[model samples]
Target chain A: MKILVCISKTPDTTAKIAFTDNNTKFDTNGVQWIINPYDEWYSLVRAIELKEADASTVIHLITVGIADAEPVIRKALALGGDEAIRVNTENSDAYYIAGQIAEIAKHGQYDLIFTGKETIDYNGSSIGGMIAEFLNIPYVALATKFELNASKAIITREIEGGEEICEVELPVVVSCQKGVAEQRIPNMRGIMAARTKPLKVTEPVAFESLTSIISFELPHAKAGVKLIPADQPEELARLLHEEAKAF
Target chain B: MPVLIFIDTAEGHVKKASLEAICYGAKIAEQLNTAAEGIVLSEVKDDLASLGKYGVTKIHHVNSVALNHLDAQVYIKVIAQIAETTRAKIIVFSNNADGKAIAPGLSVRLKAGLVSGAVTLPDTSKGFTLKKTVFSGKAFANVSVNTDKKIIALNPNAYKIETRDGVAEMIPFQAAVDDGKVKVTKVTKASGEIPLTEAEIVVSGGRGLKGPENWGMIEDLAKSLHAALACSRPVADAHWRPHNEHVGQTGIAIAPNLYIAIGISGAIQHLAGVNRSKTIVVINKDPEAPFFKAADYGIVGDAFEVVPKFTEAIKKLKGIA
Candidate 1:
């Protein structure tokens, strides 16, 4: 089985978010980059587990970004990807990125495709379904569990108040989240091997972005907290009802 | 051309988020000086015409049982055909699970610009700019859609529902129904308790609660407030709570009216999931817990001592037994 896992580089979870150039671009001066946690801990790890179950399973990693995304992709490789494809581009629009990855998936002809539910940066959660549409295949979002049998796969996903189990044929796209797999750390051997693994770079396909960012703005800061004395817990409730009207 | 709204339904009932979507679509229609219409594919128990009160003039019903459960591929095919037939310039959806599943695919199929997590009406005066949350609500971005056809998925609870005394004309529309390749085998519904995403008030706990054994106080507080229960990532990882109840950047991001955090230090990751809340109250023993910075109210006291009293105070205020 051939599986394509899509990953992206995002600011580390603890990075202080700020925008520069009049809020048109994110300031990368002191930002630390890492593999998006959902991609690393869930999508890529699940692919690694699938590969472990079947010796013939091949896992290929793909990302749409510039040179800066290489380190993050290498970290994914160390976690257990067989090969990597970089659609070298700086555009981060959801449609443009999905189109680029769809182009690669068409050529790769993989049986299954995987993506994190959404990138922590964009938080759009749209790419997986867009790619599936572009490729004309079945798409499943927010899968918490996945099991494979022969040419079919059984998947379970979270809904509003419960879980729904689904079965789809091969050549389907699935967006993964937590509960799909546990996190894995790369050992010394995997890290050394990743340094020598093939890192293929390809130019992006010509496509126009349907949407453009006009500007960015920071969320309004909260006013300083009102400290209610520990002894006056009732005052908090009274304030919630009278002043804040929270209830 | 009218603005089209996708009315989502589950268990034969219209979803609250879809009501918000209808109100949003109506306001957009008012801005564009056009009519607002709706389409529902599921088997609904409510009178379709009654939804007109939410600002829709007409509702196209497919009345297909196969669509009761979401089949994204099938829904996309049907909605795309409907959009084309109606020549809809704008499409609206509630950015919930079903919307997240359908809108992106429909956008690609129709070659339309799609904006998810929209928080406000589009600024049609100067092109089509829409405001939406980005970076998990840490910031906001104004996005412009250059496409002739545009789609907006409004976040749940981001817009208020409006009602008027009007009945919509219900038109039965004919469309092909296909179950597609994906088949749902079984469904296990979480019973009774309110789902976290839809909860207006959320009470969450973290490791400072010490162990699962001490969760009774947290439960008592949540019960008194009639709020849904949530936990931090560590609590979920430690198996103290279900993963679904874990609210953080990596878990489900929730935007509630009021969020009360007990013993959970406000890490940036945890804040990302909940900073959109209208009000926050933090209770912790440590005076310098990071959560205090983002809170609207803080009480520096141990949860064992403070949470019970807080619950009692709320009960007294509400006159609950």
Candidate 2:
């Protein structure tokens, strides 16, 4: 089986999300960049699990970014992928990025594709569905478990009220969510091998032009919490009804 | 120009998020001085005409037997074709399950400028700028669409639905609709009195409840107030609760009117999922728990003792024995 896992660069979870340039662009100042938590914790490890299940399986990693992202791509290889490819381009809005991924997927002709549910940076969960649409493949989002049986794949997704189990043919797209798997640290030997592994850097495939960012702003700070005395149930009731209006 | 809003339905009925989309499309239609029309697939239980009050000028029901279940690819094709036939310059969707899956697909096919998680109406004064959430509700961003046709996936509960007395004209749209390739042989819905997403009041428990055996207090409280029951990620991971009950950054994102958290430590991930709740009440024995920082009202007490008393108090207040 041929498996392709998609990864993106995002700010660490602890980074305070802020924008600069008069709120026109994200303020990456003092923010540490890392593989998106979703991709690292779920997609990459899950792909490694697939490789372990069958030693003959082939795994490749594709990213859409500049040469600066090469280290992260290498890190992914150290985690498990056999090779990696980077489409040298700066990250943009959902539309433009999906166009780049779809362009790559067209020629790669892989049987399975995986991406994180949404990037921690943009929080736009549009990539997997957009690529699936572009490739005309079956797509599932927020999958927790998958069981591949030759040509058929059984997948269960975390829906609003309960889990949704779906069965589909191969060449499917899945957006890995949390609880799929745990993150793994790359070992020394794998890291050394990753440095020598074939890392292909190519130009982007042209698609439609991108929509532009206008402005950004942080949410207003919330009010301080009010402590309702444990013994004053009547006061709590009155406060909830009169002041909070939360009945 | 016309507007086509895709209405998501389950068990042959409309979902709550669809109502908000109907309201949004109706208002946008009012702004454009055009009629707002809706496209509904098969198996809807609600009378299609009653939805007219939400500001639609027309209701288009495809009424296909083959379209009984949702297939993202099929819905994309159907909605895109409707836009072409109806000359819809703007298409609206509720950024819920169905919309999230299909809107991106439709955008790809039609090559329309697409924006998901739209929080407000577009700034039509200068082309079209849609406001949306970025970084998982930590910040907001505005995006501009230069394309002639725009597709917007409005976030659930982003815009309020206002109703007036006016009936929309019902028109059945004619397009070459193809059969769906995927089929849903069965729908095994969770048997619950209240669905967490649709509930106004949510009572959630974390690892504090101790075990699954002690979940009765949580259920009793939910039942007393007609609220939905929820849990934190740890509780679900521990197998004390179903994974569906888990609500956090990695779990379900919900925004109810009142969110009551019991015994939760309030990690940032968990808070990211539910900070939008209009009111939050936290009951924990630890006075310094991080959950209390975000809670609108904090009560320092044990859940076992406080919850039963709280339920009884609410029952007494409502005069329910």
Candidate 3:
């Protein structure tokens, strides 16, 4: 089985977000970058687990970004991607990135594809489903579990009220979330192997992006908290009713 | 072309988030000098005509057994046909679980530009510019969608629902349906009566509550508030609460109107999942707990004493037995 796992780079969770160039661009200064948690912890881990189960399974990692994103792709390889492919484009539009991924999938013809539910930076959650539509294949979003048997697979996807277990054949796409697999840290051996792994860079297929960011604004700073005395709990109720009006 | 909204339903009733989507679509239609219409794939038990109060002029119903569950592939086909039939210029959906699953595929099929997690109505003054939350609600970005046809998945609680007096005409639409490639095996339902995604108010607990045995106070507070229950990842990881109750970056992300967090230290991961909440109240014994930084209201007190008193106060306010 050949599986393609898509990864992306995002600012570390603790990074203080700021906009530069008169608030038109994200300020990367003094910010540390890491592989998006969803991609590294869920999607890529699940694909590696699948490959571990079957010795013949092959896992390839793909990303659409500039040279700065190569470290993130290498991290995925350390976690267990056999090879890496980077579509040399620095577009943040979800549609343009999905187009590039769909083009790569068409060339690879992999039996299964996995992508994180959404990147933490943009939080679009649109790429996997768009790719599935582009390829005309079955797509499952927020899949929490998967079990494979020959050419058929049983997948459990998170829904609003419950988890839906579905059966599907090969040549399927899944957007993975937590509970799909336990996160694995790369050991020294894996890191050494990743250093020598092949990472092929290709130019992006010509595609027009449909969306562009005009500007960014930070959320308003939180106001001074109203701290009701513990003894006056009834005052809390009054505040909730009249002030917050949350009820 | 009219504006179309996808009204998601569960247990034969229209979901509350979809009402917000209807209002959003209606406002967009009003801005564009058009009409707003809704399409439902499930068999709705609610009076479809009453939905006009939310500003929809017409509704299209296509009830089917297979439509009860969300099949993204099949929903794409059905919704694409409805959009074509109505000649929809803009399609709207609540950015919930189902909408997150369906809108992207539908966008690809319809060849429309799609924006998920849209927090406000599009600014058409200069093309279609949408404001959306990014970096897990830490910042907002205005995106310009340069497409003739557009798809928008509105954030669940971002827009308020407005009502006006009117009756919607129910229209029956027919289209060729397709059973998706995936087959259902079995479903495992979570135990909470109120789903976390749709809950307007959520009362969450943390390890500071100590153990599962001490969960009664948390449940009492949640009951009094009529809110769903949630827990930090540590509590869920330790099996003090079910995994379904977990809300964090790796758990279920919720955007409720009010989120009352009890005893949680407010890890960045936990905040990422719920920072979108309209109002946040944090209760913890330690004054230095990180949650207080993001909370609208903070109470430094012991949960054991504070929760019961708050519950009693709420019960007295509501006069509930």
> A82-197 in candidate 1: lDDT tens per residue?
99999999966799999999999999989999999988888888999999999999899999999999999899998887789999998999999999999988999999999999
Q: How well is each residue in B1-321 modelled by candidate 1, as lDDT tens digits?
A: 999999988788888889999999999999889999999997899888999999999998998888878878899999998898899989999988889899999999999999999998999888999999988889889999999999999998799888999899998989988768889999887777777887888999999999999999888888888888999999999999889899989998889889999999999999999999998999999998999999999899988988888889999988995
Off by over 4 Å in 1: none
What is the TM-score of chain A, computed separately for every candidate?
Answer: 0.98, 0.93, 0.97
Clashing pairs in 1: none
lDDT of each: 0.91, 0.81, 0.89
Off by over 4 Å in 2: A182-189
lDDT of 3 by residue, A1-247 (tens): 9999999899998888899999999999999998988889888988888888998999999999999998888888988988999999986688889899999999897999998988888889899999999898989898888789999878998877778899998888899887888778899999999999999999999897777899999988888678888787788877887788988
Cα shift from native, residue B158, model 2 (Å): 1.8
Clashing pairs in 3: none
Fnat, 2 decimals, each candidate: 0.80, 0.45, 0.75
Q: DockQ (Cα-based) per candidate? A: 0.83, 0.55, 0.75
Q: Residue A203 of model 3: what lDDT?
A: 97
How do all the candidates rank in terms of TM-score, highest first?
A: 1, 3, 2
Residue A102 displacement in candidate 1 (angstroms): 0.6
lDDT of 1 at B3: 97
